[model samples]
Target: LVNGVLVAYGGMVPFIATLAMLASARGLALQITDGKTQIVTVPSVLDLGLPDAYVLGIPPLVLVFAAVTVAGWLLLNRTTFGRRTIAVGGNPEAARLAGIDVRRQRLFLYLLSGLCCGIAAFLLIVLAGSGQNTNGNLYELDAIAAAIIGGTLLSGGRGTIVGSVLGVLVFTTITNIFALNNLQSDVQQIAKGAIIVAAVLLQRRTVRDGT
Candidate 1:
């Protein structure tokens, strides 16, 4: 909510606000534990993360991810709010001119983002069995790379849940391959950056040709 207000009414850039929150949140976490990881011992939570725990041969976490993805797809592809979101993203001024409440849309979108983040945080805790401030380093880069690679326009205006999912799978595969090859983290970072750049260039070219 604070983040939404900051971006919607205070004219702050979304990325800047998110970055600040990420940094501050991590810092506060580190301070609380002096950089130690807190282990979670609850069996129920651990079951969600472990591979041994499965339902219908599918892991709980995977099911949660799939359900969320489907819900997102339905919301974006079949709902009025999704259209408004796209319009707001593509051009806030134009959306407002069209009688859409652009600021409110932005605020709601931010709230939606926060809700997703909370879900992700829970998943992370279950997966790791421990909470550490050091985790999720360079996650923003990974997220941006995945989205752009999945065909989500950097200029905003258009995005698809399926594309984002495939992008995540591709990125995860690349990460695993890097690990298998014993590549340095720096190398993986470089690869993600290159992917983003290439994706952006391709998007621009596609836009140009379309025009």
Candidate 2:
């Protein structure tokens, strides 16, 4: 609601609106928590995040993620709404001319984003057994990088849920590998930036080749 109102009604670009949101929300959260981490003592919530809680060796969080992925995939690939979303992303003016309500669609997308954030927060609470205002700091970069690497065109016309999932998996693998090798944080960031650039360049070439 906040996102939709700000971006759709307030006439602010999504990036600027969301960045403002981040700052305001972060400030509010810090004021509420005094910039401290709040520990979770609930055994049930904490247990869900444990290694032994896996079914068939698949973590519960992975299951939740898979369910959400399937739902998103269906919504995006198997529905008229999804087509409209893609059309709007590819060309908003064209979509509006074609009778799609562009502002409404954008607002709906913002709402969907909020829902995803809620789900992510729940997962983080389970996995960490604590909550902190700083929990997701800088994660947006990884998300964007993953989407781009997953074959999501930077220009925003096309994307796939499965591809983005794979992209995030690749990004996570890189991070884990770097961490295991005891690399510095700066080095990891450099590697990630390089990967993003390479992915963009390859995508551009593909687009140019008309393949």
Candidate 3:
């Protein structure tokens, strides 16, 4: 849809379109919540069904994260759709010339991303017991930083699930270390920005060296 039309007619990059949508969605959510944080109390039955407690000596959330990581690895490494997605991201024109439906693949990728976001939101709400327009503010930066640090090319076509997981671990470790030191949010933001810049520079150097 909307993304297709924006790219076709408006000559907008898909990321820009998505960023616009994110802003709009956040605005709408704020209006719905009357600029107040909305608390969500899960019903006991639903809570019971969900992983509220530890399982197999691991926190349920940790288990869920592991499951998602494994599933992502399998999808990206073992599926035709994943191959097509990489192809499209790497070079859309070439992908189309190779008889791949580039538009369809892009659509599927966006759908998959949205599904992941939905799942993350569900997990966050469950963990926090609340929902707010600001719940994920600036999280896009964290995600991009993690991916790039993990060797996921911002230009696309190259990435590994394991690397991404490692990147997340790196980011988590940094955050925890900062928290332990009682650092300010400003310091955290500065560190994140620095990491993103460093990762991008490293990526450029690697690409230049053809590594």
State the lDDT at 52 in candidate 1.
Answer: 77
Q: Give the range where candidate 3 is weakest over 10 consecutive residues by summed lDDT.
A: 44-53
lDDT of 2 by residue, 151-202 (tens): 9998888899999999999899989999999999999888888888999999
Q: lDDT value for candidate 3? A: 0.83
| Best model per TM-score | 1
Using lDDT as the measure, the top candidate is 2
TM-score of 1: 0.94
> 70-114, model 1: which lDDT tens digit per residue?
999999989999999899989989999999998888889889888
- Candidate 1, residue 9: CA error in Å? 1.1
What's the true lDDT of residue 210 in model 1? 93
- In model 2, which regions exceed 4 Å deviation? none
Better of 1 and 2 by lDDT: 2
What are the RMSD figures for all models against the true structure?
A: 1.4, 1.5, 2.3
Query: Residue 142 of model 3: what lDDT?
Result: 86
Which regions of candidate 1 are displaced past 4 Å? Answer: none
**Better-scoring candidate (TM-score), 1 or 2:** 1
